[model samples]
Target: MDTYSFLRQLADSWALLALTLFFLGTIVWAFRPGSRDVHNDVADIPFRNETVPVDDADTPDTGAKS
Candidate 1:
């Protein structure tokens, strides 16, 4: 109801504490170290390679050229 009471109530509450811990966790996670080696150079890339369907119906005639 009054300034002192309101401020005392705020001081005892968890909102600021929760906010501080959230920021600290964010900072710690950001600084946590691990080398990504050369393999992870691209973050969101999808892997592409040797898997392909070889069904006869899907084949392109090797002798034909367009």
Candidate 2:
């Protein structure tokens, strides 16, 4: 009922374990190894190749200019 009893009860409750777990999880996550260039050396398969021509009309004549 008093302040001292409340403090003592809180110190022994599951709140202490929860707080410890939270802090431990935070430290582990903060110092965990991170990825380096995760997409590096990765290849993508594009459905369409832009380098190929779709129509012959767009090409210029290879004959003489005259």
Candidate 3:
């Protein structure tokens, strides 16, 4: 068979199966047990500095008049 045909068959079968397995494996790994604390820490990243209110003096002044 020609190179194109060989590559096409590989993509149609083995490549597809490999990609599907990789996707499922990622999902399983992300949702596995004992990962709650890690996930929660990452989720709270935005609110990490909530206790400290931002001061307006620390902000850069944009010349545009409000």
Candidate 4:
């Protein structure tokens, strides 16, 4: 068989199977047991400092009249 035909056959079979397995493995890894705490921590990153008050010194004055 020619190179093109061989590559096409490989992509049509093994490549598809490999990609499907990879997708399933990723899903399984993400939803595995004992991972809720890690996921929750990452999810709360934006709100982690919510209780802290913002300092006015950190704000840049644009000099626009109120």
Candidate 5:
């Protein structure tokens, strides 16, 4: 068997199976029990950012009349 043929067969079979299993595992991990708090924290990150006060020192002065 030539190297190209062997690699092609391996990719067509094992690679496909590996990718499918990885996808399913990710889905299972995402929806598993006892993960609600972590997911909630991630979901609230945008709202948390809004609550933080911005420091004036970080702002640049435009040096123009308002």
Candidate 6:
């Protein structure tokens, strides 16, 4: 019944359960209903800058000309 033994037992039991519940809760929250639009917007972030067409010929060529 010493401090170290008590802490070890509590951590091995309640702490483990708490962490597992927190992980499952996070998974549930991420896939919850009515969040598809928000998720889609976030997923499109990388392509946001690509919406405007880029013409390479019109841009300057910074390469050294031999």
TM-score of every model? 0.37, 0.37, 0.74, 0.73, 0.70, 0.72
Q: Per-residue lDDT for 11-44 in model 3, tens only?
A: 9999999999999999999999988999999999
Candidate 4's error at 23, in angstroms? 0.4
What are the clashing pairs of model 3?
none
Q: How many residue pairs clash in each candidate at the backbone level?
A: 0, 0, 0, 0, 0, 0
> Which tens-of-lDDT digit does each residue in 1-66 have in candidate 1?
999989888877876898899999988776667635333655435644546766887777788677
- Look at candidate 6 and tell me the lDDT of residue 26: 97
Better of 2 and 6 by lDDT: 6
- Higher-scoring candidate on lDDT, 2 or 4: 4
Candidate 2 is scored at a TM of 0.37
Q: Which scores greater on TM-score, model 1 or model 5?
A: 5
> Tens digits of per-residue lDDT for model 2 on 1-66?
999989889888877988999999988775667622333323333533548757888889899977
Q: What local distance difference test score does each model get?
A: 0.72, 0.72, 0.95, 0.95, 0.94, 0.95
How does model 1 fare in lDDT?
Answer: 0.72
Give the per-residue Cα lDDT of candidate 3 at 50.
Answer: 80
Question: Candidate 1: RMSD over Cα atoms?
Answer: 7.4
Runs in model 2 deviating more than 4 A are: 1-11, 35-66
Q: Indicate the worst ten consecutive residues by lDDT in candidate 1.
A: 35-44
Better of 2 and 3 by lDDT: 3
Candidate 4: which stretches are off by over 4 Å?
51-66
